[model samples]
Target: MQIRDLPYADPGVADARSGPRFLLWLGRNQLGGQLKALAWGLLHFCGVAGLPLGVGRAVQAVVDRSGSALALAGALIILCGVAITLGDTMLHRTAVTNWITAAARVQQLLARKAAELGAALTRRVAAGEVVAVSTGDVEKIGWFVEALSRFAAAAITVVLVCVGLVLYVPELGVVVAVGVPVLALAVLPLLPRATRRADVQREKAGRATELASDTVAGLRVLRGIGGEELFLGRYRQASQEVRRAAVRSARMWALISAVQVLLPGLLLITVVWYGAGLAQDGRIEVGELVTVFSAVTLLMYPLRHFEEIAMAYSFSRPSAKRAARVLALRRTTEPSGVEYGRPSGDLYDPATGVLAPSGRFTAVVCGDPDAAGLLAERLGGHPAADPDGAASVLLGGVPLDELALDEARAAVLVQDKDPVLLSGTLQELLDVPSSGKVSAEDALKAAQCGDVLDALAQASVDTDGDGDGDPMRTRITERGRSLSGGQRQRLALARSLVTDPEVLVLDEPTSAVDSHTEARIAAGVKELRAGRTTVVFASSPLLLDRADRVVFVHDGDVAAVGVHRELLHGNAEYRAVVTRETEEEQLDGITAIGELAVLEEIEESA
Candidate 1:
């Protein structure tokens, strides 16, 4: 976990049972760093505890007219300084290491979960919550982790100081030994209520953050509909609620701090007051009383840690819980090692009775958009779920999920209706790992991205003359928001084309484009993917007409299958679904046209 050490080959597993248990797990994982911090903390606290003894002994020696009191005190002071300096420096080093290592570990775990679950992770958790846990929550967790050892060291110092006082001067010692523990433990009962208040505050804050994120993500749409003020008012109300919760939480914490300060002050007064009575009775020396007073005052510093540790734990517990929720997710279609799915065969969906041959274009037409999407997801091997007696899609005869994950993914790619183009340079976005076969230029051409390239080129101002007029180097804004609807869709289609999978499933890939451009894109895709398996989920006549096989889905099942023109002539249901027209209505329109033409000829003859 040190800065100089190499990266981890394995980031290790996490325990996500509960907040406290996860905290304990983090501590255990970073035990070496924790021990380093603890050792340094011990040295530092011991150094501070030794200071009063040196001062008290020097005072007593001075009172007795000793020859070398100053010399002994000077030596002890120097030794304490060295110990304190060494301990403080190393303590900082190790504590920060623990904090950073813990945070990095959590981030890695989150990244691993994200990679495993892909886009499905966000469906199961709030986007804002995921953002919070990975950023703010991780730091709070690390803060608690680093604080634990320091608090332990402080507690031990308090105990040691009290025991020394009791052994040296019993009369005043008994007072401190009893008073310090009470001061530390008195605030415990208030912690629960305070922690609850803190939790409420966190919830309110999370809601506000989520609102802000959503409002920002849809700012363009909000402005188009003139709903800025409405969203603003909603967010304002959420912000105010957070403020109220925060204030409530602060009040509880304030009460705890007041107790912490008040109780310690009372203890100090008791020690001084009682030690004076002992001096009056000649039970202890003045110098010993001075020592007793200094030691009790010193306890106040470490006692502050008690409050800090409480606050840190309160803040980090909820954070850990949120993080645990995200880390607990598992992919539904786990990869299989022993069984490999069929490499080259028709992709068959048992639910829809649709089979895409190995080297042909297939189009699916469904009246229900939602059902089409679910079927598309299933065809891509990322099904929503598997209920009892449900059949899985198979490549050849083997189940899709039975294949290794990489193999299944390599076999098929489903470009959703609304695909996302990540923020980056155009080149980086197209540089997918599995895209060695299809060149970016070729894919872009097939996707009819000529205007998209021009738009990107116009937006980019290349500093070096050598980089001029090349669209590949154009930088895209986050989520491609800077591009128009059609331009974004074209770019997404181009990006997906470059993947060069064995089977490409596109759901309405050209729905956002103009009819002319969509017609060209349909033709280009047919030419580019001539010998590969390509299934398009679309009802557009231009796209459907290009398919070698068109399967019309009715009521969540396959109703008809044929070439687009053949299906139009042969299957009335398919015609109605694709063209939004029925047989009798179409006949009536043709007869009405004939009657209008006949009346025009009669008027000409008259």
Candidate 2:
């Protein structure tokens, strides 16, 4: 039952089974890698059923003149060519190691259901259907679990070559045991119309891969609103409705491959027209009617593996029911096993009169950037509110959904103001999840980032200089797109102040820098986060004047709290919402005559 013990199994009895009973509960939880790839696919289908019993014993040793029957038909055609090349190389190395261990156990059960729905798996799935169920529904559930060991070694080599042609020649084994079960149950009534056209071509290829991953994650806000040819003509009409549902699921798999080649060429012309009238009525003998017409032409090669295990279980049962509805999303409140000990120091909320208290540097100041993104998802346990109601939030005396997702992500760390700068080195994006606990020159000197490490050491010595390096060790593109939005918000607030997280939070984190690099990042984040538990959010009056506490909020609650000049001399709606001072007095009355001709050229050049 490995694959890390199937994520603690009983996700409520895997939500009442189905998708072929969750592939028979993943072949009864990988029954020893499907019984060692079904015993090397029944010793590679008994070496392809000894190649039609060595071509009907080399055509019954050339109609038996019997002089050691052509050296026993050249030693049964060199032992049927060394048992068809050792059963086609152990049936393609045990069916490609049962399709790479059933696609590495459905990609380790969709990465343990995306680490048990962390960040609530993109609010319940559709990040292009979890990137098309982690890549084409994990290769169509490892091509129907390695085509169930070559469909149980092609149904035991079509019942041992129709019981050895019904004991040599019973009317050509009753026309090959009644025409190999009518050409393997004639594509089982066209497999429920080719599995409902391959589940409408896998739901129009997961809605054309969720409209091309939402038009490439909103191609830079749809090309800054030109709406990039209206989202590239709605992703070219969802890729022509996924190319007309993949040409109606390839016209029902080309009419099930033209009835698997016209029912095995009409059962090899009814076993050579009734075994040529029982070999001219001698009651079968021309070497047992050429060994019952070469065992009905080797029962059409295991009835074409019963039409390829009915087209790999009609395209892996809708890609294992879209990976079992993304491992049945959960989290509505569970982690109560305690252990969120350290926080005891301030970040209360109770709907609005926010608190923030702990080690200091609080800020908030909202004015509705969606109520500061729902108060940074209720101060980062990411969603589970209700700490005794009234807008609820709290941290000191614990409650961010009773902690535990690794102790509420190791005591809070939000960051987010378009943070996500993933793909690689600026020292591996400030060595995320704390590898080398924050170095890169103390997170680029608390993120003032010495001119982004001298412009990545002059673009890595103009793209390659033999100099032994330290171009901040190169690589950063992705969300860092080679730098700037104030160097990706001061390298994501210097990788969250190199995870000194006891409770960092942030949100605005110098919303795109400037005001003298947001007053040297509010005094280098109050001197490299002095006594921890930060918060910040920001309406940037230079990070709310280095906040010891600010609050403000509004319609969603906490209309005012303290310091930023005591809420600009006692909160007149927090000084008309953080001194947009009447839009800077209507932009100083439309630049008052170009500010008095730039004050008469600074008093006639002084």
Candidate 3:
């Protein structure tokens, strides 16, 4: 089956079952491929089991008659060789197919779940855990899945070979039958301990991965603050801990391996010693004795599979649990009876007593940045305010939580100050998914991205690849690293404009740009979003001036709601804050001018 045809849809089932149950579920789902693999595996094992019997028969035939029986035995031996080679080849091919297909299915399922959850996924599970599960856990799961059929085939072959020996040579068969189980079961007692150690190793690895991801993501900030050394030291400590855990895990596995080898060797010795006595009593022929010994030797190969299966399970169980935990995270609770149709008008957050009436440009001006952030979250249904309480965000009187996920998401779009830029080209970056039908050119014009387009054009001219004339087709590095901070911010704003949701909630959108650029953006935004509901959370006077209405948020509540001019004129506290900010800017300007004057004087004196 194709990987695309695998069951990737989120099943919405909690993974609260035991490891064995989960494995069983996987087997049951991939039953077709699994059964085929098992059949081939059985055929392969039967061929292997037939080899010793053929050899023993050939030896006995040579001892009896010299011509015809020898020829028949020779033919049997040649057929056994051909069968074994063919069976081994088919077995390996089928087993590998099963492994790859199972891994692909799990990966598809995880990807679908990630899409379903969106931003809510990280809120539920750590980024590191998700990374681990997708990369490491999926592979281990496939290993165990593929190993299952081989394990079954090996076991069945051992049992059947032992039974056949009992029928053909009863004295040696009893010894072989009894010895195999002891070897397989001896490792059982070590499994629980090994599994526990494996769990610890996985946990440590996850923690180390999380620390490394965080450190790398924040490396620039840490370096700027001269804390790189400290973070590096911490990472070194974490790496050491992982090393220690790994050592412990390795030690357990080594001990299990040693026991696996020692027990099988002991079983072989016991069988040989007991069989020799039966042979002396003339109860078994020399050829029969050789066949029993060869069968035991062949049985050793399958017994090793028992060890391998045990080890694979021990390693894979924790990974499966982690994947299960990630899949179990619910994206949203079931919607109530409050049917959410198209929003009528306006967005209101009853919690902060803030409302942005529909089809109007609203600006939220908060004195405290933290309060502004919280207000933005509330407005966009991010924190998802309590339903029973009076602190709910509503779109056209429908509670945000009560609305279906698609409806709620389509109704409002929250653009943060530092927006994430996924790896793609400039055109793909601007073409984010949204219900509102807005063109890329229109959004670009609204964001005043002439300079951005120019930069892309310059890059395209310098680039030595085909189709380089299209500036929009230029590949952007992950998180738009090729772009400057202000450029990235503006590009993000343009993308949001392209979405053009009913309510566009932006938090400090132009905080990274120059005043001239900020002014142009403010004017362009006002003109582009003329008849839509756009809320800008900023204390910038340039943006505040263009808003149709500005709400003064103080101490987590709306202090006043009016035009910028009205607020500036009336509210003394608001006036004091704005006046202080303007004074600081003027003071900074004067200091810069003073420095320039001193430099001019020095040049004149020289």
Q: How would you encode candidate 2's per-residue C-alpha lDDT over 1-606 as one tens digit per residue? A: 344444444433343145777776776665666676666666666665665555566566667655577577667767767766776676677666656666776777777667655554765677888889888877887788777877787787778777877876666787787778877887788789878887887888788888889789878888887888987787788788778877987888889889878877877777777777777877776666666666666656666777777778888887788778777665556667866576567778666667777888888877777568657766776653323354335788677666667777777777777777877668777766753454657766767878888887778777777744576677777777877888888878888888777777878877777666676667777777778778888776667766788878888777677777656655556665666556565444433334334434543542
Query: Cα miss at 574, model 3 (Å)?
Result: 4.9
- Residue by residue across 12-95, what tens digits does model 1's lDDT show? 888988888889999998888888888899898888877787777778778877759767976887888888899989989998
- List candidate 1 segments past 4 Å from native: 3-8, 339-342, 385-389, 461-467, 570-573, 580-606
Instruction: Work out the TM-score per prediction.
Output: 0.90, 0.40, 0.88
RMSD of model 1 against the true structure: 5.3
Off by over 4 Å in 2: 2-33, 36-108, 111-113, 116-126, 131-139, 150-152, 155-204, 208-243, 259-263, 281-306, 313-358, 364-408, 415-501, 504-532, 538-563, 566-606
Candidate 3 segments exceeding 4 Å error: 4-22, 66-83, 337-339, 366-378, 383-392, 434-437, 465-468, 569-606
The numbered model that scores best in TM-score is 1
Residue 403 accuracy (lDDT) in model 2: 69
For all candidates in order, the CA lDDT equals 0.83, 0.71, 0.78
Candidate 2, run of 10 with poorest lDDT: 7-16
Model 1 quality (TM-score): 0.90
